[model samples]
Target: MLSAAAAADVRFYGGAPRRRRLRPRSCLASPPASGGGCSESESEKARSLLVERYQDGVSKRYTLDGNSKLQVHWERRESAVNTVEEEEDANSLIPQAVKDFVLPAGFPGSVSDDYLEYMLWQLPTNVTGWICHTLVTSTLLKAVGVGSFTGTSAAASAAAIRWVSKDGIGAFGRLFIGGRFGTLFDDDPKKWRMYADFIGSAGSIFELITPLYPGYFLPLASLGNLAKAIGRGFRDPSFRVIQNHFAKSGNLGEVAAKEEVWEVGAQLLGLSIGVLIMDTSGVKSSYSTLVLTWFSVRLLHLWFRYQSLSVLKFRTVNLKRARILVRSHVGHHVVPDYAACNKEENILTWERFLHPQISFGVPMEIMFDGEESNDMVDRLLKLYRNEKYILFVKPSGSRSAAFFVTFKEGATSMSVLRSLWQAHWLHKNLQRQDEVFTWVEESVLALEHGFTDFLKQMEIAGWDHNQIILKVPKEPVLVIEHPDQEV
Candidate 1:
């Protein structure tokens, strides 16, 4: 029933910890799709009792004691704890230095003007990215004879008309198509005027720009925006007490169906000028020109988005296009979604950890939207509805920060939250607030084995019998790794 978009995995790291030992817990698998909990099997129970003899770096043994209790013996902090507790503690990468905060510290930068100046620097960056991507893609396309110049006016004119169709149809589609669909929402009425005003502003901008193009493309562009505006009006209900307000009237819900008819009057005026320009130019579009136009559309779309902040995506999507190509990229699969990023729009651009696409041999840099972990967890929960998920926890310390988790896939982001919300895991496992301890990131132990080695290292590093909380990184790098691959 709630709006959906994010959250996956069971691994989570955060501030604070609980001093406790791990015990037999629920299996990693989600309850049988029936909204019911699943029980641990006998083999799973027996697996818990087997004595684990560590052979890598400082070797040790993990075994259940005579009283049927888990016990651990390591070089430092020897105490028996279950797999789950160890997995959760692996999250802690204690910061070496805690930074202080005070006034005029609204931004992390030394001065507010510095941040503004940095943003202004991005305009050149956008132009650069657009140039590079266009060149590379054009080169590749040409190599394959994708869009070559062919001198055939009859075919060229048809190509031009065919090429302009999506945008042209979309322009008209926005109004009636948008208006008809807008009625589905039953939002507050007072907010309608605000949305209407925003739409009008967007429509005005489009109208101003439309005249630059020819008859077919210009009106379609403007109309498309107006249709979008009409749709927006229905989505945003008006809360204004003045029922007499014209915008709240929702006239026929058409793009031209504004409270004041003059709104459309201005757009039509622009459209007329565009029609005149198309007739005067009388230029015919050749096949080459049509192909160029198509590529330009895709280029502008991606560049415009890159010009903005970060884009969001889902885990299940099968996107073949990679938006970025970082030189030393750390790619992975269990990435955060748009909802997790708390972005207003659900932009479906594959924001690969690929860093940025190289333009002029320099890494493309854009604005970084590293929303804090609290905000991330808050917004991400809306995406999961009675569905079980998993997560991989990558600490935010250094470029080579060690991957922290016991499971091959890592810990679940929701499991930690679910425990708190459901009020079950901590109490059941005896995690007291006073007993938790954290391992500083300065101490990245080199273990020999894989998941088992991580648990042993935590105990060997003196985090034994202590539930360490791994604080979620503000900017978590979403890169999946191989089971044996070093992170």
Candidate 2:
């Protein structure tokens, strides 16, 4: 047996000469447990080892064997397996290089929670729609006498000029449509998205039948391209609104870049498929095949478009959502959240036949019957003296009435929502043939007393009150100079 100094020297200096004396307990391992009653317990040993091992501020991973001996292995600190799975799932089939090029960095994280679901439906839809679009273009070109003559001639010049004029007309149509319905894109993106798709389908139909009426080729082509251009105008704006919705991380620029990349890739794939179809069936392909292919693909596009958009649960309050909320609250005395309202709403509801006709931002001239001294207008102005909006209800031949709400200059999104609720409540009461003055008074009272509670419920339900989706006109804003005064 060695002396205590000799053993200490051997332990610290690896059996060599000791450079200096040091405490034995400072090392990671405790001095081999001596067979004594003072031996450290397993739990106490683990605690001591943990403290000593982690004193450097670096976390070390370890496990104990059945004998309670500390066992450790090093590993890289990286993302959790589930997190990687979530990021890679939707793009699993895409190559890594392609994903890097087209998808935003930290893609799904950079977008909304619904981004993956929307893209899954959008991919297949865009691919098929582009294929159909390509087919229609080819057919329309053939009808317009593309590739028929190599050299330029008088007839060719005339045909070329006509084609150029067709494009010009289409451009004008786009501008007109965009100007007329521009606000709708922001106010109700989903509905406009559907309408744009339908219009595009109609354009395809027009282009499809061009070969049948070659004599009327110019008119048909012009009309087809015009509709298509208008659709494109609406489609792009609506898509921008949706992209804004999806950009959760303030990465709008990145999201837009990735969206363009996806669109280009889809277009390339679709063009390749279109070329395959063109090769398989030559230019002289029958009308039956062309018509059948166009119709089927358009139908598929619309279905997928609907499926993709229906999943988006926008927390904003649009006209349809407002109506749904008001109707539900009035009936059940409980307000549904954005998610519930979205599920109940339809994207393609162009006309609410069962419900009363409701219009927002009616021109002041129409509201006042083009006369400054109208008694009814005076009464309405007096009635809404304390409010930022004026409401007018026109009784119709049917149970349904036309409800119009015109916003004053200083009106806000919240005020617009409140006006909608008030109009809906008034419409409901009037449907029961309640006295008009009495119901109007009750509606105003309900709004004044209960709107704050309504807003609170909306907040609790996670509604984003800041984004009002009401469609008010840009021009002809009605200004109430004396908002505080009675008429």
Candidate 3:
């Protein structure tokens, strides 16, 4: 094995942090015990012990006796000699190159649940660019003495509001109207996508693109595209699926490079056009004309691209968890409790589903004991008096009998959970069957973090830990991970 110092040392790129000392990090195979290195025999012994310990960790599920008590024994499921299967997967944002990048310590944990904040601050990328660009341009115009602002009032945007941005009221008015109108639609991904494409496309063009917008319309186009991306991401699960595809195998460095150059090149193009317009039109204010028009477009374009990169960066954050959660073996897989869990090997991939339901509202989940249901659906609907609840995460993988149902906003959480539970309880008993069932309230953060913990808990057992699925099949279960707590 290499020395700890040698293993920790890494050359920085392009003189970055040249003088700043790198904190030592080590991947030592064994805990440090002595003042010096262990003998060759001792090292070999440690290696063997590690192998044995790792093998032991891949334990099977504990067998339950007639009284439902744990038995210190193993009961293996029949090997799937003729069939093949695969594991479930969580979505990621970018390819492996950017996957190495770490997320902020308090990332999704710190992300707010305020819908209005998301709409105003995060949803519209072009608006973000527009606000930043207007402020910068108006200030610059004041410095050069271009438009109406005469004396002390010039520096502030409030004075140059008419000249620089006579559009905020209309834009904000439309935003509020759209939010109100959106309440009419139910939570259907297909319907949501249709609305997003039409609305987002129209909004981007109307709100962002000026007639002489900089970069010869390329920046405008980029902003429009980003707006669409934001819109789709807001309501469509498939939007995240596409983002995850970019993260899984796509090169983020190349993407970042292309976006950076696109911003700069587009801005330069706008500047050239502005200069041309000044020369051809014989405008007396040539310097002011070029600076005001082209610079504003370019600056806005750059900011738009910057905003886009920020979104991609968040998408990249998911990869950090995958590094620890996923483990592969030759012709097999590894997880926490493999001995008692499903060990059937297959060529099928359960991760990539075509129709992934994305729920934006608060969710109540029910895992029933049926393959497919109509009577169950009708019964549940009649029980709740036809209050709408969308089907979100379909129960698949090892536990394929369950289904996830989410209650929309304004629905009482306790009432929803209670109704679902009571119905399932009575239904199971009346059917005279010991069917597995559960009902729980879940959120986006809760579901995702639960999956994260599920993967990690499985990892603790061993590589072939498929036999030990982390989601304990019991009702009223909550798994909470500490914020900022080290895994």
Candidate 4:
């Protein structure tokens, strides 16, 4: 009878049918050698039987062992790759420029400083002084307007008149409030003197009228002394109380007061000047009044536009606000997962484009645990298993820092190795052995709005039919605008 182990082996290899049949040792034993030729033939038959068994048993076992090793290697490599990918994702979310870097530290200049300097430079010295005086006067006028009109704020009054009004009363209400009970005196010599007295020791009709300058012109002057006072007062207890009151009231009272002041000033100034010119020229005053009205309208337009631009420029350059914006953007890059894995981190550094000469410095390098060489090899093997293409680069010189390897989904190691050989050979032939050992896969073009334009540029550069390899899932692997166009 066959041994139990032999029967088990037979059953494992050939299944139950072979397991049922077993010969006794005496019956299965080979015949004794009779002579040279016959014995050789018997020996050969036994050898052949041994060879068939080894091929079916040992060879299958070896193949299974190899496959298991491959699977183990694949899992190990995938884990490493995933770790690197996660690190990269984390690095992209940091807004290194805004949060980590200090801007305006050396200059000692704030955004307000720059704005003031810019405004001062825009006007002539005399005009600038006049503007400063006007702004000071206007602040007093604004104060007077605030103190006089207790019912509603100016902003509220203006808002109430709009199609989508924001407050109770409108601009017309301000005009009415300022002149209600005929408080606004006629623009005559006697009234001018009275107005001058009310403005304290300034003692000039011009001082009372200074605040009536267009909104744009007023700020240039306002930024100098007027802004300084307002800014300081804004932070003070007294000013805050007034501000809080206006804010709570939706600013209708303040708005109405300023509007009333402006209307009274404009009407008085226009009528007085018109009457004076008409009396001197001996002409009917209608034409002069019309001219004054036209000038007022044009001035108002210019003033509004100027105010809009100034506010826009001021907001754009506000250092504190700009830093906040940069930090938010960089944070998205540093923690891409928190930002929902969007590739926006890749271009988060692009904000520097908005403000050139604003350097944030290089990003900090992330450290990895494994040796780069081993990691690279592991990556290559994984790519091969996936039937992807890979490129391996070895720099020639002793000074070379690193060897680069890149892989894509549809490439093979053999093809990549061939490209590496070509690069090495080219360097050698050109006596550019200094560049030896370095391998590079061509970086793919990133097209923004004009992908078609980039394709056309590639065609013009004689890149027809050249296969371009791209990296992913960072970006699209290939972008072919037209089948005939090369990426």
The TM-score leader among the candidates is 2
Deviation from native of the Cα of residue 227 in model 4, angstroms: 32
Worst 10 residues of 1 by lDDT: 359-368
RMSD of each: 24.1, 28.2, 23.2, 30.9
Best by lDDT: 2
Model 3 residue runs over 4 Å out of place are 1-139, 143-157, 161-200, 208-255, 266-487
Give the per-residue lDDT of model 4 (tens digit) for 1-487: 2124233212211011122332222112221242222233332332110000111111001001111211000001123655675466468664423322322222234345575466456658756775565445434544656322455555433422221221111223323322231211110112222222222222222222344564433333323323233222222322233233345458856865775797699799978976775575434546545455545654674455334322221111112222332233223312112122112222113222332112111000001112233233333333333222333333335543222223233333233322333323233233343432232211111111223443343344333323222111211011111122221
Model 3: worst 10 consecutive residues (lDDT sum): 47-56
Ordered from best to worst TM-score, the candidate numbers read: 2, 3, 1, 4
The estimated TM-scores of all candidates read 0.21, 0.61, 0.25, 0.15
In terms of lDDT, the poorest run of 10 residues in model 4 is 359-368
lDDT of 3: 0.34
- What ranges in model 1 sit over 4 Å off? 1-263, 281-392, 395-487
Candidate 3: residue 351 Cα off by (Å): 14
In angstroms, give how far residue 405 of model 1 lies from its true place: 11
Q: Could you tell which candidate, 1 or 2, scores higher by TM-score? A: 2
lDDT over C-alpha atoms for residue 153 of model 4: 53
Pick by TM-score: 2 or 3, better one: 2
Report the error of model 4 at residue 404, Å: 30
